[model samples]
Target: MAAPAATAAPSVPPSLSLPPSQFARIQPHAYLLAHLSPPSASNQPSIRANGRAPSQFRVTSANAGSLTHTNGSAVVRIGDTAAVCGVRAELLHTEDIASWSVSQASSSNKRRRLADLGEKPTEEDEDEDPEDDRAHIEDLNLLVPNISLSTGCAPGFIPGAAPSALAQSLSHQILSLLHSTRLVRADDLRVWYQQPNLGPEEPERHNENEQMDVDAEQSATIEDKPREIKAFWVLHIDIMIISLAGNPFDAAWAAVLAALRDTKLPKAWWDVDNETIVCSDSVSDARKLSLRGLPVASSFGVFEADAAAGWRANVIPDATEQTQTGKKGSPERWILADPDGYEEGLIQERACIVVDKQKDGKTTIVKMEKNGGWTVDTEDLRQLVEISAQRWDEMKRILDQC
Candidate 1:
């Protein structure tokens, strides 16, 4: 048999395997798209790489008054993103401000005129002249909001480094929203004192025969001295991002809202003898801030299914089915709510809706910010608003419990 025919070497089929994590790391776009747009034969509902539905948000939790040192403090977490916010109240004397006198004079005159007209200032009036209503807060910079994200909260963020551009941008956005919403009332921050009127130099009425009774009667008839602003409580809102997975703005804003709601400034009064403001030490004397409305932020990202279409076309041998279905030319898109870090990296288009639902069952859109893509339209905005309303309800309930 001629050396016993050499047995054909057994052939081993080519094989390769990779863990899900390794696959995601190597092919992020493909990995996400695979979940978002599964094969037609699978008949699976579209979902995100993080195992959440397109419109689903991560669970949120908040805890107020967590820090004892700060006047108001809150810890908030939305999924893996977590933040701590503190509100510290400091007194700013009117005498220290150069423009306080001028602004106070103008404001007093306007108030007197409004009083004379016998018409109380209405929301419509304030809306017509928002700049005037916001003058004190903006001009004085009473509300100082700063966001810190340099504590190695995420990759590329080195601890102890200077604030990154993202941090500055978030700070600006928070400050802008605070001013636009007028969430904190200026009246609550004002510390007023009545001026003592020394009526026309009474010349020391020590003698009983000097018509002391007549002078007393006349003084009683005189109108009360106008109350002047002695000082204002400046709120320094500091937010620190402990962990950032994505959707940082929403977490930051929620922490701010919760902390502000928990904030209670001490009752303060002007001390003439010391020529300074005095704050009550008793806990019972602390007063909480009167926030105008609960404005909640909801952010979404738009991911085009065709982000890697070109790569797929190059890799796949056949394009006949894709061309016939027209999917190759026009791929579908998804609006992902509360996108995580992985999803945020793959998405470019985004929209943020800030809404406040009133006690009267009316929902008000406080602000809407969108950028990067035109895939979202008016109908999409309406749907986002509905989603935001539900989010607002959830946040409200959590905050109330806190």
Candidate 2:
């Protein structure tokens, strides 16, 4: 079957309407200049005024507490591109009372039986009350690009349809990166309960090591002690891509850091063994999430476009400049660092670098993804590492302020 004829552009009020040409003309400065500049000045003054090379970064700014409704909220802006993230916290509760009531009854009965046997209920019970906190965390969803393309960057987007598939992929990359690095700890939100009164007949203390002889007639069974304290904090990160001026990864990272800065975990009472959760309102009752060091990711583009030859290879940085220089004129493509979107349009190879910093003033590249287009010599890789180490402390300072 033949494809349906394209429909005419929808007519709307002049003030609210924009032409396709107008939208297309609003491309990134890097893109526009790359094509418009004279060959003599093609690469001159192309980077931002902040002293960043075309491949370098601008002065990234991040701020927290932009929203009152959320537990935490932050805005991260890199040049003109901006991303806002808000964290909303809600306690987990049973949908029906029957299930909860039954569980409570079973626990109470077990305690009663232990009391009757002249055994004291252990302090272990104090911890079980917060088990539900972890469940609350797992149920949370981090909505990225939540506002979608309605902001006008993506014209003619279908209603109810998500931002394009590419947007989803990028968002997932940001979300998964945050999760795997343990940037947000789930156990810091626990709130303890009021002390329960013990009956007069109960023993003052019971030796935990001493086991009671099992009797068929007895009504109490001791549960195995929990090995790990359950996580009590539930961080619900909502990332809204306010504007996509390119460089979504950096924008996402800055947003996540900012969101965490103002984040306050709600106090919760928990039981690990029983997996129960109770929300607490007092600030004194809550604990802060421990922040591991910031693990930042950088991507470089390796573009090799020979329009005359009718050949174009768009690739990310798979090797450093030193390596490519060593094999000067080698058709084998390789890039040291990931460039912005415009650079990607002309790249033939690429690489991804993830740097991890230690508390002892040491730094190392924990992860590297390299492609075969080019190779990075050890010396140039060392230079990149040195640059990262020098910049990491500054980055952490910026993150801490958020």
lDDT of 2 by residue, 179-218 (tens): 5565554445433443333323333445633223223212
Candidate 2's C-alpha runs over 4 A off are: 1-51, 93-150, 153-161, 189-233, 270-277, 305-328, 331-341, 370-382
- Measured with C-alpha atoms, the lDDT of residue 38 in candidate 2 is 28
Candidate 1 lDDT over residue span 137-246, tens digit each: 88999999999984668888986788889999999999999998999888778787866665644667767867677677668755534567798889999999999999
Q: What is the lDDT of residue 344 in candidate 2?
A: 47
Error of 1 at 12 (Å): 4.1
**Count of residue pairs whose backbone atoms collide, per candidate:** 0, 38
Distance (Å) between predicted and true CA of 128, model 2? 16
